[model samples]
Target: MPEHASGASSKLIVESVSKWFRTPRATVHALDSISMQVAAGEVVCLVGPSGCGKSTLLDIIAGLTKPDSGHVLADGHLVTGPGRQRLVVFQEPSLFPWLDVFGNVMFGLKLCPELTNDGRREIAHRFLGLVGLEKFERVHVHELSGGMKQRVALARALAADPQVLLMDEPFGALDAMTREHLYDDVQRIWRDAGKTIVFVTHNMREAVCLGDRVLLMSQAPGKIIQAFDIPLPRPRSIYDVELVGYAARIADALRGTVGGGVPE
Candidate 1:
């Protein structure tokens, strides 16, 4: 585990963030004046259409990409670049093929010369177990299924004891069955670990399942069209979504976002 400054803010804040991409032919407006805040320990999911800049916004929050205008903050401090304090878990496993599960998970720790070998091992093992991959620690990344690979990536991120986890559709590539299983696993690990997570996805159910609040984005110039505080309490599973009105509210929110900001 890494050092945690006592009494420091862990909140994530974004203010008037706008990002425009310059392609070979034309400039595209990705995000416009996007502002949002997620308190420490809050799970907020960002959902939008294909070109609505959902992932771009996530990149800004993670400091993987810089915004042309506005600011991104973590713990009330501006986020400029990637740091161990904020780990980004991608849709697929981005492990080094040359390294086995253990080596891959321990890669970041290896660079942090401050931690001892024993310290790194303990952290890696704890997170692997947290994601139900303790038995697979010695396995190669190539041998793992798509779901398992993503789990490893997630475990790698979790092993760092991140204050804020930035996940970009971490299950988007998995089959429905596997995605649901991983969804349950993710929910368990996130709650048990008490992490502040910002998950991005187009799947409405996934958003509702993972987020304490769901923020829906509009077209190219993404902005929050609607945000709903999930009334259902955790330990909330996919099965619990049978509530009559909950589905409609979520569906409406999803449609409203992708339907180009029009109220249905």
Candidate 2:
């Protein structure tokens, strides 16, 4: 947690968090006393080595798994379980093959039927266009490219209208070019929409380029070892990336925690 605490952080707070899992063979301590915070509208990226329990930490926050101890508070309210205020986007699109793009995006609306059909469609279309999927509204999941599907997932998350978004390697499976494209898209939408996002990835540059504050975690029983505030300006282009030291600066910190390097 560097000194960027000027309060632009979106009101996401995790206090003294820890989690463990029971197994037939033995018990495993997945996370140990992890704590951090995301100021409003800030992109806080978490990066660590393999098996560092990064995903497990995410699960705990998303309320899919409860921590053995500790608490999570969103916007000054305690989080007991998954709420409509928090939306998640996983590495996969998590869309139903049976549902078309529009239906998939509107799936969460089932829980909020109070919203009229037209109202739901209006919000869905706005987010879809943000992800460059305005034309694929009627297309089914199988008809989309990897990037397009990711966009749909993003659109769905946006449609849910959550104050905070949880993203787990949303572009980890895509090619470099596609991933970079989505990276730019996410930055644009995140800034304009004024939502708090917590993203997890093994890609250091992806973390550096998108995060306002990047948190580096250690191995199992994970903890934050470094936090860097990216001082670069917005809209850092592909060709201009070399001029920005964000990638290199964060790479050094990540390599320390990774105990080597995950080559690009």
TM-score, one value per model:
0.90, 0.93
Choose the strongest candidate by lDDT: 2
TM-score of 1: 0.90
The candidate that achieves the highest TM-score relative to the unseen native structure: 2
lDDT of 2 by residue, 12-99 (tens): 7788888888889988887888878888888888888877888988887788888889998788788889887888899988889999
RMSD to native for every prediction?
Answer: 4.8, 2.0
lDDT scores in order = 0.80, 0.81
Per-residue C-alpha lDDT of model 1 across residues 149-221, encoded as one tens digit per residue: 9988888888877889999988888898998888888789877998999999877777777777888788888
| Candidate 1 stretches greater than 4 Å from native | 1-10, 242-247, 257-264
Q: Look at candidate 2 and tell me the lDDT of residue 67.
A: 83
